[model samples]
Target: MAASPSRRDRTLSAHHRKKQPEQVRRALLDCAAQIAAEQGASAITIQAVAERAGVTKGGLLHHFDSKQALLAAVFEDLLDKMDQEIDRTLADDPASRGRFTRAYVRACFSDRLLGDRSLWGALSVAIVSEPALRALWSAWLDGRMARHAETDGDQRLVAVRLAADGVWLADMMEKDGGLKRYPQDFEVVLLAMAEGGN
Candidate 1:
């Protein structure tokens, strides 16, 4: 009383059998992220990703249902990595107060978020252009903010975080790396503010 597998399902099963599903999925995601970082998100078609990943279109499809889903996965992967980086930063700090805010400042200034050549900078365009991607980013940020409210809920810390955001936005908008013009102590100042220092 069960229905037979469709041709597409059978093909996907074959592809899964040939390649480790987790490995193939990771490869596809990496390839897609690389393409987006190198050529912009507009170049991330199923064909391009499959070719870049050295997998067939069916194989890529077996991992991602569509180009949008693949893109979402790529963004999610980046977010997860960023989350880990923040945790690593926080782990270095002994103080609990403003720890999350300091990590946010550090991340905003990180090379990964500052230059157009960085993956985050490259994906910034896609995030602005894609509504779904934007929503995902917003949701992730909101969750992080909520999770850190206990330690970083002070209004002064919030302002410092917003200033860090401004710094990042200015860097993202500038082509010649204008953020470097600020005094070398800019981040130090921000970190002090993050801890409610004068």
Candidate 2:
């Protein structure tokens, strides 16, 4: 005869028997990101995230010690995705000069962060308003800038990067048509500058 599982075992199984620890952690981060994207960062309570992620509060705690920690982790995850997008963009370009800067411009214009209604757009409010998140973002920017110092260090390239950032910021804050309101050739001009053109 087969033996039946006990209450504790059933509870454990219900929580995450099929998912590995990493999977659970990933799920938690993804759930948090979705909540932040849809409802803004202020809505990301631990209880809300845990319930939405199909885990108990204690289970979520096992992965993230506190709400602030979870928010930081979610922000880091978003930055990681941005890094991947930049890397993919870099891979397609053959030019060495201004390569990293060009990738940065491309990423800024990418759908992931282009407008107020985007996932990154939803999260940008937190990135700028939350002190902890802003610190993390600053550190990340500093590191990338340092790494690309050799290739993207030209003054003109730096100016182009700044322009791209301005456009992205404007788009994020725009309540109307977003990036479409900008000149159609805006990105092209940035890319041309990235390529060291007139």
Candidate 3:
């Protein structure tokens, strides 16, 4: 019989084995996102994503059955990532409890700064034009905002939330030389609103 594998070999075997499928899935998603970033959402289809991912169409179908499913996956993945980021940001705050409002606002700004909004923004045209995608986001936001009702349902808090989203949206949709003016202390202003200092 062959000699038993060494610990190093076994460890490498397990690590690579575990990572393979997840890496493939991540690669597929990245390809789909790149398509959305470079070509717009309408360009994302099974064949297109497969080609971008350097996988067979059958491989793409193994991950997503249809374009609708693919788009849903993209939205769900992106939202899930943002939710995790919000949770982490909240945990790092000095006053964690009852600070969901501050955490939520900070998270959106962080997303604008260090996140994937540009790719998602490129897909905004598709999101706006596609009634189904619009409904998907609408329902998701409705449920999410309901959960953060204390922050989003109240008038004062809602104003800040909407204002942040509006700014981010404007930034996303802006074309060169369209507008350059923004409140210099915007995040500071948002923090004040969130902290009831305004």
**Over the stretch 39-65, how does candidate 2's per-residue lDDT look in tens digits?**
777889999999999888998999999
Show pairs that collide, candidate 1. none
* Per-prediction TM-score: 0.83, 0.85, 0.73
Model 2 has how many clashing residue pairs? 0
Overall lDDT per candidate, in order of appearance: 0.82, 0.82, 0.69
> What is the Cα-based lDDT of residue 121 in candidate 1?
72
Query: Can you list the residue pairs that collide in candidate 2?
Result: none
User: What lDDT tens digits, residue by residue, belong to model 1 across residues 115-169?
Assistant: 5567777777778788989999999989998998888988898899888877766
> How do all the candidates rank in terms of TM-score, highest first?
2, 1, 3
Model 2 bad stretches (over 4 Å): 1-12, 15-19, 112-117, 183-185
lDDT of prediction 1:
0.82
- What number of clashing residue pairs does each candidate have, in the order they appear? 0, 0, 0
- Candidate 2 is scored at a TM of 0.85
